[model samples]
Target: MVISGPRGTKDMLPESSCRWHYVEQMVRDLCRLYAYQEIRTPIFEHTELFLRGIGETTDVVSKEMYTFTDKGKRSITLRPENTASVVRSFLENKLYAEPQPVKLYYMGPMFRYDRPQAGRLRQFHQFGIEAIGAAGPTIDAEIILLATDFFQKLGLNELTLLINSVGCPQCRPIYRDKLQAFLHDKLDGLCEDCQSRFERNPMRILDCKNENCQTLSHGAPHMTECLCDECQGQFLGLQTLLQAAGITFTLDPRLVRGLDYYTKTAFEIQYPPLGAQSAICGGGRYDGLVEECGGQPTPGIGFAIGLERVLLALEKQQLLPDFKTGIDVYIAPIGDKGKTLAFQLLHQLRRSGLSCDMDMMNRSIKAQLKRANKYPARYVIIIGDEEVDQEKVMVKNMDSGEQCMLALQDVQSMIAGEMDN
Candidate 1:
């Protein structure tokens, strides 16, 4: 029987992988410009870390985690999201001691157990960043700017920036009470999930996607309307900073993120044409996550972009960038002596920083030429027994169908010249 890969998983083949490489490089280059370094964490972690960091009441911990017990009877889970693990790394690695606020970025696969959809998968990749130990609206605005700049870099200009304030520990309780009281008589109208959320987290009811829950949530007290003095100032300051930065946004009162750790400023960016699943990315200030993860109280904010969804949006907009899928050089060897000489030249060209490939199948000259064109090599170096005896090789340019004769010693220089262009 033939075995197939699991559902909700995808393979990045050669053609598709080149685009991934381009996207990854763009992320690294852009983050470098913003003075943010990269960080990588383990694929899985102790289950309690997420349980404590992300609230137990949230859907991630309650339903979607890929968790199992090990031989030592310790429960472990594949990371559904990375913010909590990053906080753990911050505390454990003592990143907080070095700087006031450490700026970092990451790109990797994340696992979650959920029903697969168009752009969402059980296994997906994310590009995210975090700014820790800084509390205030300036960093918050900068985060928004970085996210927009990245999208703009990818030619994603048709986007909606939605912002809101979820209040802090001090004032959320009051609004939670008001929200619960407001939702009290309307409990029966909520979905099963929203009904359960009412007892543990009433604010999440506003974020529910169910149409019935949405109607029942209409005219409900918004968190922006109930912000305390400090939260009020920070929210206003964030708006002012964004406006000063020339970034336009809309205030979305019902934009409560799914995570329980989020506090204060919350935001999301969406491609309006995609409709219900329009959000390309979302994040917010989790000022309380560090403390919740056993560190001295630190303020933090960041966002994670779902790469698959971003690619989907790019496809919809016809904005995906073109990628070159060919090597720099292809070597075709004629006979025993030529094969030996070809190996030496291939190593030399590669060591000098040129992408080089050679025919291993020992096909006829005509077949070798065909294979070289498949990689669509920019330059093909042919070393036949006669050419080896003459101490010369034929260099063919695949694009313009141009050919030139070069001495054996000048082959590397010829390919190096091609690289400069």
Candidate 2:
């Protein structure tokens, strides 16, 4: 009998893992430069956390959650996203007692039971950052700028930033009622999901990907129109901050994100190369989330970039890194006695932080040379009893086709100097 990994999961071989490391390293470095510390939360949490924090009306809680009952009779779930968990941790740990606006970043797998599609899986990784306890519109603008900087660092220049403000608690209710009234008459013409969403979360219907829903939402109520004085002031302040920071963005009134905690500013970054699934990063200001998780009323803003989607975008645009660091040197032995010496040298070179490989299957000298040629090594070492007895090794320059005998102790220094050049 044989068993395979569950569908929608991928095995990351070395070639692909190299690319993953490149992206992860970039994320870590950028976050560090921006003074954002790393935060990690449990993979699973009480089901109520998501339901209350993410909102029962949102698709993430309504349909996508992977929930199960543990032996203790508690409803536990593998988190579909990180914001709620982070907020929960913040409240539980009382990080609010620290600095005014705590900056944190996280990277890990998030589970969801959605239909598998290109760059969409039941299990996927996300690189996200959260800035908590800052109510200033500049915080929102800075988060947006940070996201842009991250994409720019990865050489993704064709991405577009679309931003909007969904108003706050004081104004959203008025807009929701107006949107519901408009959609109520057109309910019969909408998709089943949109129809259901219209009653529960009318703002989400504006974000539906269904062509008919998109058309039906035309001329529908815009959140900008119903924003109260305070919300309007906040939106203008956000625009001012973005302008002051020299970050260009387009105001999109219809761009409502599909989450419950979001209030005021919401934004998405789209990479044109990925076709329909072009959004590479998305996030918004969930100023009420901290209070929703039982903490003091704290304002927070964040964004999450889908690692798989970013890789796909990079692949489409031919922006993937070289990914082939290759071996530093390949060792070839000419005889049985030479083979034993080659093994010893291989171990020593590896311990010295040099990537070295030897022919373990006893291939002929010619075959070994051919295999070594396949690698991107700078030098090839030929080991035999004559050179071993002489306390020297034959080092062949792979690119120049030049060979020289060098003392064993001097080989490391020679390679280091050549690499520096």
Candidate 3:
């Protein structure tokens, strides 16, 4: 029986994988420049970690998680997001004992049982970073700058930075009460999800995507309106820091990121060209999460970029730079002797830092040349009985249509020189 891949999964073929590699390299380089080290955590974790860290009121925990029970009777869940897992690692590994603030970046697949859309998938990839143990607004502004710098480097210039101050624990309760009071009369008209969130997490009701819920929430109390002294100061400080860095942003009071852990400095980077699901990256400060995850009280902030959505935006805007995955040389061997020589030269050239390939199918000279062209080799080396015996090979520059005979030992140097030019 033939079986296909699961729904909401995509195979990245050769042509498209080049673009993914380019993006991954860019993310790595940016992380290096920012002094953020890479961190990898398990793809699955104890289901309780997410249930508590992400808050059971959130959609990811309530409706979207890939949860199951293992043979050991322990609840296991494929991670829908990494921040919770990262925090769990921090607590379990005693990373908090070493540094004042640890900065880490991660790139991997995340699973969710959501309905698939243009860029949203059941199993999607994310590139994200977390800076734990720092409470200052400078770190917050810097994280935003890091995200903006990455997109700018990729030529995603049309992105909009929407920033907001989701009141911290000190202030959110006040706003929650006010919001609940405002929505008390409108409960019957609200969606089932919003109705449940109304009593549990009224702030999340404002984040509902339902049009009717949105309309009902239009005049509801905003988090900024209730920011206490500390939260207010941090909010203003974040704005000042970002402006001092010459980064412009719009204040989006309605931007309550779909996470329970976020506190203050919520922001999203949106690309208008991608339509409704335009947020390619979103994150904020979570000063209380470390303590929530069984660690000492530590301040933290982070953001995650949806790779699939970012690629879609890059494609829509024609921003991807040229990525060539072609080999530097293709060796077409005509006979057994020539094949032996080609194999030796292939390894030698590779050791010399050149990408080279040889035909193993034993095709005719004409067929070998055709395969070389299809391989899109920059240079083709013709090895035959006569050339093998003469200790010379004919090298043809596919681009310039220039051909010349070169000593076997000189071929590597010739290609190296041409590459340098």
Top lDDT hit: 3
Error (Å) of candidate 2 at residue 19 is: 1.1
- Model 3 stretches with alpha carbons more than 4 Å out: 191-193, 207-218
Candidate 3, residues 86-134, lDDT tens digits: the string is: 9999889989887768999999999999998899999999999999999
For model 2, the local distance difference test gives 0.89
Q: List model 2 lDDT by residue over 1-421, tens digit each.
A: 7999888888888889999999999999999888899999999999999999999977889899999999999999999999999999998898989987999999999999988889888899999999998887888888888899988898888889998989899999999999998888889999998887777778888888899999988999899999998778778998998888888888888898888899988899998778776888999999899988888898999999999999998787788868776798899998887888788888988998889998887888788888888887778899888997897889998999999999988888888788789
Q: What residue pairs clash in candidate 2, if any at all?
A: none
Model 1 TM: 0.93
- Provide the TM-score for each candidate, comma-separated: 0.93, 0.93, 0.93
Off by over 4 Å in 2: 208-217
Candidate 2: residue 240 Cα off by (Å): 1.6
Residue range with the least summed lDDT across 10 consecutive positions in model 3: 196-205
Candidate 1 displacement at residue 413 in angstroms: 3.1
Q: Score residue 308 of candidate 3 by CA lDDT.
A: 94
